[model samples]
Target: MTRVAVVGLGMMGLTHLNVYRSLSNVTIAAICDADADRLSGETTATGNVEGTADASVKSLPAEVRRCSDLNEVIGAADVDVVDICLPTHLHVRFGKQVLLAGQHLIVEKPLARNSTDADELAQAARSAKGLAFVGQCMRFWPGWAWLKDAVNDGRYGKVLAATFRRVVDHPKGAFYENGDLCGGALLDLHIHDTDFVHYLFGMPKSVNSFGYSKNTNEPDHVVTRYLYDHVPLVVAEGGWAMSDGFPFSMSYNLNFENATVDFDINREQSLRICEVGKPIEYPEVDAKMGYDLQLAYFIDCIEKQRKPETVTLENAADTIRIVEAEAESIKTGSAVSLG
Candidate 1:
């Protein structure tokens, strides 16, 4: 069995805890957080997204150790994997500590606040004895994953154009309000689509962006066009600046040579396909939350002593680099060239 320790009992942390409880081959070796209440099972976390698998777990397992310090979690002999779900700024530091302790590492999205720090963690991961993976969940999401395979396998022929969107009500809490810490909605929320865009089609030659801020100097709502040589059109819009009571939604539209794939989280049939003479078709997908599948993937990699190719530390860093270009493009009011 793989023993796991999860640090930071925030929204993502609690999500991870619930998933770990559901996995048959995993054991919750420890749970760490700065908050003593969470460590002691007196507090619980609620995420922005609804329908998370078993978010009702408020108590830690009897066999699991609870700690209020990262050092303790890193030093524990029972822990074979360290999952870092801390805030954006704390990722590199705590992640490095996990690597230094020779534990397999899984860091949450937006691996670091900036590319510089992302590179540092990537270097550390490269030298660590254990494997490393980043939770870029969109690549594994049911509908999105289907799109990836369709685009790559040419089942729908070549991708001609695409549009992606993720918009939600502003998250509660001061941490999210601070642009420096959370990197605004563009980096914090929009990075999901940005990374997935890169995953489906390689890095773009440039990015043309327009954004406006609601919370800080950073862009709160941004629309970016990823310029590619072969793909005629690729645009993504994401933000959390919507008014209160606005529903959370993520959707995409892809045009291929032979068919069109449409996905919307709010729809009854979330994944749809349309060909020239065929009626609309809804494809069956694994339909599992990306969060759960990503961790399971990491465990499988660890068991086989293989590196993760789906989402790597370097690839996560590259996503941040792409976000940086988008930010720059927003600031300059022009398209920024990227290699």
Candidate 2:
């Protein structure tokens, strides 16, 4: 069995633990967190997508280890994989630690806060003995995953125009209030769509973005148009600036030469296709959530001793670079040329 340790007891951390427990050949060897209460299961954290923690996750099994120090977890012989679910700022520091220890590493999305740190982390992953994978989970998400396949296989002919959107109420926590630490919604939230956009259609030639800030000086709501030569129109909008009661939304609309695909997380039929003189078709996807799918992929990669091609350090770094360009565009109120 592949032993795994998850650091951080936040929403994502707990989510990772749940996923790991459900897998066949994997075991949660340890859980690390600086917060004593979190480490001991006195308090719980939640995310926008999933609500309160499951009963099984409120506390781990007796055999599973718990520690407050990261070093101890990395040094443990029983641990073969360290999943870093800490804040964005801590990713680079702890990520390098796991790699240096020659243990498989899984760093949650955005890789790092900026290009400089991302580059540093990417280099460490390259030189490390163990394999590295970034948690760009959108690539594995059900509806979103189906969209990627359709784009590549051209089931409905070339994509004519595509628009993606994700929006939710601002998240709570002091860490979020500080723009530098979280990179605001543009980096923390919108990067999901940005990375997915890259996964579907390579990097764009240029990007024009518009943004609005509600809590901090940094942009919280962002709408970017990705310019490309082959595709006629491609745009994405994401933010966490909605009101308290606003429901979480992640949806997309794609117009292909002969068909159109529409996806909404809130809809009963999440993914639907339309074509002239034909009935709408709903495509079925894997029942697993993106988090579970991503972790499973990494476990398979580790077991096979194969490198992950789906989402790599370089690819994650490039996603940051693209988001940085979007931030610049938001500042200048003009299109930023990436080429």
TM-score per candidate, in order?
A: 0.97, 0.97
On lDDT, the candidate that comes out on top is 2
- As a TM-score, model 2 comes out at 0.97
lDDT of 2 by residue, 1-339 (tens): 999999988888888888887899999999999999888888878767743234244557888888899988986799999999999999999899999999999998879999899999999998899999999999999989888988999888999999999999988888888898999999999999999999999999999999988866688999999999989999999998898878889999999999988998888788899986799888775667798899999999999999999889999999999999999999999999999
Alpha carbon deviation, residue 57, candidate 2 (Å) = 4.2
Pick out the ten consecutive residues of candidate 1 with the lowest summed lDDT. 51-60
Each model's backbone clash number: 0, 0
- In terms of lDDT, the poorest run of 10 residues in model 2 is 50-59
Query: How well is each residue in 68-122 modelled by candidate 1, as lDDT tens digits?
Result: 8788889578999999999999999988988988999989998999999999999
Model 1, C-alpha of 81: deviation from truth (Å): 0.6
